[model samples]
Target chain A: MNRRLIQWIAVALGAAIVLHVAIVWAIPRVIMSVAMKRIGGEGSVNAFMHTPRTTHEFRAVVRPSPDLAYSICVLDLSDGPVVIEVPASDPYTSLALYSAITDNYFVRNNRQDGGLAEGETIRIVVAAPGAMPADVPEGYEAVTAPTEKGLALVRRVIENDEAMPRLDALRKFSVCARAS
Target chain B: MNRYLYWASALVAGAALAAVSIAWAMTALQGEYRSGPWYTSAVFGSVDADMYTRARVAMFGLLALDRRETMYYTAATDSEGNALSGDCTYRIEGGDLAAHWWSITAYDAASFLIENEQRVYSFSQTTTEREPDGSFVIRVSADPQEKNWLPVKRGESFDMTARFYNPEASIYADPSAAVLPVIVKEGCK
Candidate 1:
């Protein structure tokens, strides 16, 4: 047999491997992009899109929790900083911020007086680091997202079936709007 | 010129082969060893994670909390080192359910919940029928059982994930010593 066939086989294997790595690396980016489009494509920069109900059979997203009620927001900082507000509730409240590449860089929970606001509302400004406009309004604290494109997620733990109403009320506090 | 082109092609191919293999190994070996019966990693979704850990977690989903928040442990094989098969039946018997909230969820090889007539995907602490000693046994099979049965469809392989919310510190410190459930193979059709 000629040596060309063996060489070609090795070359093909190498090419396949390269393609595999590229796909693996790009999977997270592509998934996040798709998620952003699905959750916020029609809404403006500050609109909050709440997931109706989470189930084990949620095929659009992978490995979602049946224990938590989630609300999603797409942050587009190129337009301006978005003000994220949530009402304090019992049990617990937490917000996780994911970058374009899906890195959860910032997570603030109700503990440490972090998300704890009692009956009042908790307000935070999500903006790109050092890109926050100086004229932004007062009383809205700023937390920087590592990327211009990011996802803001608020998760509320459901104790059981009876807790759905209370959980629904708590999840309603999650809203976003462009800050002038 | 033709010989030079051949050598260049081989170089690019070799690089691709190495890169792809490393990616597969990362998914295979990265977070699969964080526990005894579970493969939960503290590094998932953390901002402080290294480059590789971040890549692996994002490959699956964008949402995960720190270990103090939630711990997701997945098992693809039984304790005896057999790839979980939907063609077989397995009995998962455990002692007291050990976490603030604990659940055992069944996912197909593609990572989706297995479908059945009941449309059930998991059994948790608050729902499972317990024995007199408070121990619980969950039967996993393609066929239906009378009680404490979790359906696993046939024709495709599957895996199970044991999720613990705020688990005991010891379970995280030394999971091998933790009282994980026993997965005993029962019968196959």
Candidate 2:
């Protein structure tokens, strides 16, 4: 009610307003930065999975250069089937999908280990969920890749669609044939 | 009376403004999780029931959330250590299921892969083949055979997730299982 009391109240109100602004503006940035530090990049708690290598080295020739960083590896682990390993390639960078490589004998529900028989040629392609072509090799339905989890793959071509031919064509560029 | 009214009005206005600002901030945060033009949340729930079920099955909760448990999601296991499935995809690549292993996988909010041209997904484990000193490499591209691969398909947005199974207990006392990394490669034209 008095002049001094009123002056004190005004100061308190101004301080409260400043405090409110600081809380609103600065808190989120601080929280996010801390969170990011914990889960910010490769090996962060928030990553889908750490790949075997930092960059993907595709043995095949890319088409018009797909949109993303990639490394190509074409080495024959053995003188056996040519197995193609696919990654989870999605336009959406946030959602991480589980993937796998498989031979053409496994069922859609059942899974098989990836010790391919000698001389078998397996084409491995990676894409986001539902991105896999329907035309997979016969006997080989998609199974989760062993190295990576929750992904599916096929050993044989079940669908005789155009994707198989296109993939075959691409395989020509992937002649590195060694796992090392 | 006029003075009292002015003071009261100012106080009320300030409180209301603060409340509105806080509400706006919260709403903006929620926007980050919204679906795109082709899908509504309800529709996403319905259309991605299978994927949703899988995530639930994997993490044993809605949205693969378990605040009390490990930070990175851990898959459900039976007393005997068998990983079950609710149609969600997951694989064990390298980490020692018992100790020192790491994995990377993909899933959306609904726990399914966004539609795309390739169906293949790959995750390599810590025990996955590595260079001489135990350091390893993974390939993340449409073509996995090129070497180490982590796939990212085309969609408006999605999540790439990693899991460290039985990580080196010393990394952090409260290590998270779901470690995420920004895998966006610029200039993919």
Candidate 3:
């Protein structure tokens, strides 16, 4: 090949590498944004959208485990911090936080919290990086999120068909709201 | 005009190549660990995940937890290196897992639950029946089995995800060392 052809090949290869990196870097952000919008739906930010049991018909997210009942909170810390409260359930339950770029920054389960007694709740204050509210209430754990906007997911294990009613009721009491 | 045409063609060709390369990489790359037919990535949902792992997880498992919270193992092929098909019956055999709780769920090629009449999708540690020796067996096929049946579409491909919630420390140190279930292809329709 001539010098001109070599130059063209170089340009093409360079463009390919740049495009490849750019797309790979953007995938998580774009997908997470779309998920937040879909999960948020008509509800405002900083509140939990208590969804029913995941089934084949549930298309809001892919690869959803049918065994877990999910309640989502689309966290938007652009304004301020948000608070989340989860009611401890009989079976396994967890609250996991994911950044806007899909990194699971924090996770806490019922067992990890020393297996709280009945009628007890797990309260967490999620704020932007270095923006935790000073007035966070007692008994509430405060955490710093890596991004201004992300997702807070609570997963409750559904042992069997018979246990759905009780678990569903327990998940309804889970709350997500602006930190006062 | 000729220079503009050449540049345009080169850029378009480059873009096309990138698209095909990314598509192939997303499907072909199976993380860093492979145990039998099961494979998992430790960096999934962690800040340390690379660009490719992050992109793949975003597409396949949007909100997956970190390895410390949950270790997710997936198998698209059987132990004999055959692609898992809905037409084929597989005997998923395993014993107790080293986790607080574990579950194996079936999904279609598109990573969604395979729609079926019974709406059955997964079997967990608390749900499966055990043998006299304490081991368990699960059947994956289009037809119903006598016990522990996980249904799939008749003429489509599928995959299984084994989730180990709060897995043991040994599992996190080395996932391949964990004794995951085996997917043996029994027969096909």
Predictions' DockQ, in order: 0.33, 0.03, 0.76
The alpha-carbon deviation from the true structure for residue A81 of candidate 3, after best TM-score superposition, in angstroms, is 1.0
Docking class of 2: incorrect
Candidate 1 lDDT over B141-181, as tens digits, reads 88888788888878778888776665677666655555668
* Candidate 3 per-residue C-alpha lDDT over B1-189 given as tens digits, one digit per residue, 9 for 90 to 100: 499888888888889888988998898885689889998988888888888989999998889988878899999999988999999899999998899889999998878988989888999988999989999999999999988999999899999999998899999999989899889888889
| Candidate 1 lDDT, A1-180, residue by residue in tens | 679868877776766766666766776688788877866767655677777556555665566665567887888888778888876555555677888887887776665454465446667888888877776568777788899998888876565567778767666767787876
- Model 1's DockQ? 0.33
Expressed as tens digits, the lDDT of each residue in B64-161 for candidate 2 is: 21111112322222122332222222222232322233344444344444333454333434224565665544434333334444454433233444
Model 1, runs deviating above 4 Å: A1-27, A88-92, A111-122, A132-141, B1-8, B32-34, B95-99, B168-179
Q: Is candidate 2 or candidate 3 better by TM-score?
A: 3
* Residue B9 error, candidate 1, Å: 3.8
In model 2, the Cα lDDT at residue A86 comes to 31
- lDDT, residue B29, candidate 3: 85
Candidate 1, A135: how far from true, in Å?
8.5
Write model 3 residue lDDT over A1-180, tens digit each, in one string: 798788888888888889999999999999999999988976678988778888898887889998898888989898889989999775678899999999898888888746865446889999998899888889889999999999999988888888888887777788898876
